[model samples]
Target: MTVVEADGSFVEPFVTKNLYINSGETYSVLVKADQNSSRNYWITTNAIKAHHDFVQAPPPISDRVIVLLNTQNLINGYPHWSGNNRSLSLPHTPYLIALKYNVTEAFDQNPPPDTNDIESYDIYDVSENKNAISSNSIYRIGFNTTVDFILQNANTVKPNHSETHTWHMHGQEFWILGYGSGKFDKVHDTKSYNLINPIMRNTVPLYPYGWTALRFRADNPGVWLFHCHIEFHFYMGMGIVFEAGLEKVGTLPTSIMGCGKTKDMIRP
Candidate 1:
C-alpha cells in the first residue's frame, strides 16, 4: 500500500498490503500497531519471475565508459562486472563530497542536454555488445540548471527477458514526467508529459523494455550518486554520478575526508 496526499491530487489512488513496488518506485504507507505488541510479525519479500528460462546463462558483463562532462570526451573505460576484461572491485577511498576550503579543481558549468531532444534506446541497442553491465558514467552540470533525464530499459541477453530498474537520485527529488513501453517517441511522449501535478519522487522505476522520463533542477551542490537501488545491478555498474554546483559548495567534515587527496591535509 502506497500513501499519497489526502486529496489524491498528486498520484493515483491505490491500497494493497501485497504490493509490487517496482524498481525506481517509492512508497510511504502508514502502519499502526493495532495487533498485540508482544506477538512477532514477519514481513517477507520474494522475487517473482516474469518469464521462464530453460537454460540459465551466465550473468552479463561489459566495460563501462565514464564521461566527465560532455559525451564527446570519454574519460575512461573499465570492466563493469565479473568477466575476463576487468572484474568489479570496490574503491578503497570514497569521494563522498568535496570540501569548499580544500577543493581546487574546477568542474564544467554547462547544463545537461535537453531530454526531449535525446533519443531513447534499449540496452542491447545502446550497449551494442549484448553486455548489460556498463561503466559508472557521470554527467556534470552547473547550479540551478534544469535537467531532463530519460531512463530506458532493454532486453536481456536471454531473448524476451527484460528487468525493471528502480533508479534513485541522491540529492534532489525530481518530477516523473511520463512512462511508456517500446521505443520512447520523444514527440508523442512529450505531448503526454504531465506538466502540472506530476509525481515528485526521489526514486522512479524504469519498466522492462520501457522508458521513464524525469525532470529536476541541479540546485544541490556536491557529487551526487544516481543509481539503481537493486544491489546486484548496482554491483554490476548500473549507476552514475551527477557532479553539480561545485562553484557554491561548502567544505565537508574533516573526519569524512580521511581518504583520497584530503588524507594528507591537516585536519582542523
Candidate 2:
C-alpha cells in the first residue's frame, strides 16, 4: 500500500507492505494488485510501523521539549496504566471553565514529570510494580508555544509482556517526527528526527519497548485531553489533560459550564 495522506492531512506518499492505523487516525493508501490471477493472495497486517520510510519536517524549534514514559503496572493487585508516574483519573469538574475563571481548586496544576528516571528504573523489569500514582492534574502550556513530545513505551508488570498504546491528542494535530525502538536516546535519537515532511496526525501509536516523537503548537485555548484511544486503556488511567491559554478562549457559555464549579461565573 502507498499512503498518500495521514490523519486528514496530505503527506509524501509512503509505500509499505503492512501498516498499522490507530483510532481517530486516518490514512489514504493505494494498492496495486498485480499478483497471479489464478493464485490466492492475502495482505498481512501487523502492529509494526515503518520508522525510517519517510521524509518529513517538524515545526520550528519548540519553546519546551519534554519526554514522557508510559507504563502498565500493577497497583494493589490491579492493573493500571500511567504516564510519568501519574495515573490519570477523570475529574468531574469542567476543566475549561475552571481554567478560565481561575478555579484553582477544580484541578491540580502540578503537571506530571517530563521524563522518567530510566537509568534507575529498568525498562525490561517486570518482576514487581514500580510506578502507581493517581492524579487529576492539568498540564498548563503557554499560548502559541511550540511543543515537542517524545512518548516512550515501557514494560508492564507481566513477564516479557508489553502492550501497544495509541495516543490521541485533542485541540491540536501534531507532526510525527520519528519512531525508535528500545530505550530512547535523547542525543542520538534527536539527530534522527525528520524535519522535511513530517506527517500531521491527531493520533499516533507507540509500540512496546519503543518510542514515538511528535511536535505540535499550543495555539488552542481551553482544556484538552491527550490519552490512549483505547477505551479500556484510558479507563484504566492512561491519559493526561492540558490547559492552554484558557484566558484567550474567552468565557464559556452555560452550555459547557455548570458541571462542577462554573456556577460562580456571571452568566446572562
lDDT of each: 0.55, 0.82
Model 1 off-target regions past 4 Å?
Answer: 1-92, 96-128, 131-137, 266-268
Local accuracy of candidate 1 as per-residue lDDT tens digits, 72-185? 101144333212112223333443433254343322223323232224333333234433222323456767776777675655445566677788889987777788887667
Per-prediction TM-score to the true structure, in the order listed: 0.57, 0.76
Whole-model lDDT for model 1 versus the true structure? 0.55
How does model 2 score by TM-score?
0.76
Which candidate gets the maximum lDDT versus the true structure?
Answer: 2
The residue pairs in collision within model 1 are: 23-166, 23-205, 24-166, 24-204, 24-205, 64-135, 100-251
Candidate 1 minimal-lDDT segment of 10 residues? 65-74
Each candidate's clash count: 7, 7
